[model samples]
Target: MASCILMQFPGTSDPTVTVIATGGTIASTADAQGARVPTLDGAALIAHSGTPIPTRVIDSTSLDSSSMRLADIDELAGHIQEAFADPTTSGVVVTHGTDSMAETALALDVMLDDERPVVLTGAQLPADDPHADGPENLAGAIALAALPAQQPGVQIHFGGMTLPARGALKRHTYEMQAFTSSATTPLSRPRPVGVHRLAGKNVVVIAAWPGAGRAEVDAIVATRPDGIVVAGLGAGNISADMGRALGECLQAGIPVVVSTQVPFGPVAFDYGGAGGGNTLGSLGALSAGYLSPGQARMALTVALASGTDPAVLLA
Candidate 1:
């Protein structure tokens, strides 16, 4: 909350929502050579979209979403929690890029399981485009953040739809409707309040592809990641050889999370044999029910960072 300014929106008394800007296409504009670059900060974007209630602005980062990394997201989480801890702020809206919006949103949802509204919104078109969609999307995000949704979880507000971070995904590349819920519905949201307390860890996600085997796992383990997530095939199934290597990961004291590479549905133990969900379960890998591999990684990272064993989250 230090150095953060209460926005002077015309004709407002009480500040209710705080817009945390992490550079995304919403704040980007075209360069001389037609390359898009993040040039607008949170305050400028808010100026275009306008706000209903009194609000504040915090310029967190100005990097392109594609250039963002896990460390940057961890820092952004701290900023959002700081805003939430402010007694005057009732809700928070996050303006991010579409590239990693789902991952950031899911991290907040898992780490901050509070009742406060944490809404994420971004744009597909750059701010400089005549047909840019950032303004309406920003307005929608602000409105969602200001309302008491009564549900406890992180949310992505775009295209007039508010979805839970648990199941939100960036499904499209060029479309404004960039997100889709692989699950039947959103799981509501979570966000740690009042501090950047999330644990810092090296977590990796390895997906199952044709001809993939133990070699991939060996390379991943060589880096000594704190945790590993398997983007398994249908029903969370990995190759037999890869499964053995994952067991080695567990034996090394590094936790492994099992999530499906498929678009939707929960991981089931219906299959048995090498590389099947049952084998991974026997090897002590945790299943992320219906969570995408990226989202599962976020959950594991948060849980491990908090010093909580993620075994309970497997359920």
Candidate 2:
């Protein structure tokens, strides 16, 4: 079990922002092999943030964001829930890896039903770097988390912008301004579903290509996943053979979600034919709307684990 450390700043009477640190580049230091690894904990990150906000730091997992699993997300959500249980805790700040931060933000956005803010932030450069952006990003997240009049739900605070989690995507690999969101409004707040572990629920994402076919879909279906999300081509259209294979999965009681490979815009039912979004919808596959494939996968995993209908939640 992870331990919590209460860091009392100058203002004891101020509402507290609980900082939960799950290691990412913000807390990482380069190893002997010149590869960065997570080495700093929540307390260290808060210190680096240089913020005066009263806070309670919890040292969660130390891991690269790419190494995170569904179970890890479940654990992180549990920590956020625990932090919100305290009446003095006004909001929460999560220091996460940029690689998978958007997915975690989406999970928390849908899972928690709190009015208080939940801000996720991380750095693109290692903590030890002279021009590291972790401190500034962490400072912004803390400020957002500490805002008394902030809108509810989860958001990513990075590169000076606070983006809603629903359609958030990491657009740049190593840039300070890494995330972008096309969603204009907050997601409908879901009733708190307590803690749901997605360990056993298997959901996979398959990218559609120019000539993707049944063999590609067959290989994934052979794994017998609980659900499948197709990152289809423009307007969520797959090749005829790929669409047929996905249709079969739907017939077998597997949920299929159609998302677009394009960075912006929603998946539209603008085309018809074997591989069209309209055809996939007719075959019982749900459209992911504006969701990126990664966000769709997280939403699908949570929905399946919580016994929520993917059609109602995802489509």
Candidate 3:
């Protein structure tokens, strides 16, 4: 079910803020059987903030980000649009599940028409946990949302840091400092100044490539011998089907980047030569080194957007 909590900023004359809840661990509760049950909403989260802020429960059910479809993202985009359209709505906060949180945040970043601050927050543990991070994350998000300078683009706030949607990634399963940005530093940090550093003009998304296509995979090598990071199979392998396609791109003298399909490790060429490893490595494909898939993508995009040599991606 859905419910909400409202909390206004204490002792501040600032305008009210609206938090839209797309339920996750924050709203979870415990059933009589002791199983986790999340039933609260945005308003409930606001109430948990200990101050009354104008809040709304846009959606009550917890939607895992990985399970989220393009349609769901579109729906969220619509809500964000509507929320910003209202002059009374200063900023918006979205409570979301950690899975695919970066993807959802990125989608919102691309789709949101306005510049109003839009923040996405969630927890790794349920609200009932003594160590649950949902409440504090929500509080931080709301605090940022109320700020006038936080406007424009979408952001993910967790563990007291704010990250740009297109750049944020969940780096840990249990650590409070889980979400991070690649290459660029985080936008907001709760410190002495509590600054949210907006990105420079260099951030961007390139035209959708055929590899990001739905059906068969295809490779697109940009004009420069730029770094091309492939989300490879286990141990940095590529499926036979994808290997053939990527081989064609590599033979053209383009650098192919290989990143592990898994989230946590480096894309290594040390795996057995089977599964497109030998084939790709022989073609001068480079490993992503320390960069995650999302980080690799962002680095590539920004480099491209900046018109820098793709070779710089390796640097």
- Candidate with top lDDT is 2
Candidate 1 TM-score, true structure as reference: 0.91
- Give the root-mean-square deviation of each candidate in angstroms: 2.5, 1.8, 9.5
Candidate 1, residues 19-105: lDDT per residue as tens digits? 888888999998989998999988798889966567788888887777767777777777777877776666889889888888888
What is each predicted model's overall lDDT from 0 to 1?
A: 0.79, 0.87, 0.60
Off by over 4 Å in 1: 1-3, 9-13, 188-199
Q: lDDT value for candidate 3?
A: 0.60
Per-model TM-score, in order, reads 0.91, 0.95, 0.61
| Model 2 agreement with the true structure over 1-315: per-residue lDDT tens digits | 677998875565668999998999999999999999999999988888899888999888999999989888878888888988887888899999999999888888777888888999999999999999999999989988887636656889999998888889999998789999755665554554446887888899999998777897899889989999999999899988899899999999999999988988889877888888999899889988888999999888888888887655554
Q: Judge candidate 2 at residue 107 and give its lDDT.
A: 81
lDDT-better candidate, 2 vs 3:
2
The TM-score, computed over Cα atoms with residue i paired to residue i, of candidate 3 is 0.61
Q: Best TM-score goes to which candidate? A: 2
| Span of ten consecutive residues with least summed lDDT in model 3 | 189-198
Q: Model 3 over residues 217-267: C-alpha lDDT tens digits?
A: 342443343445677656677655566656676787545666665655455
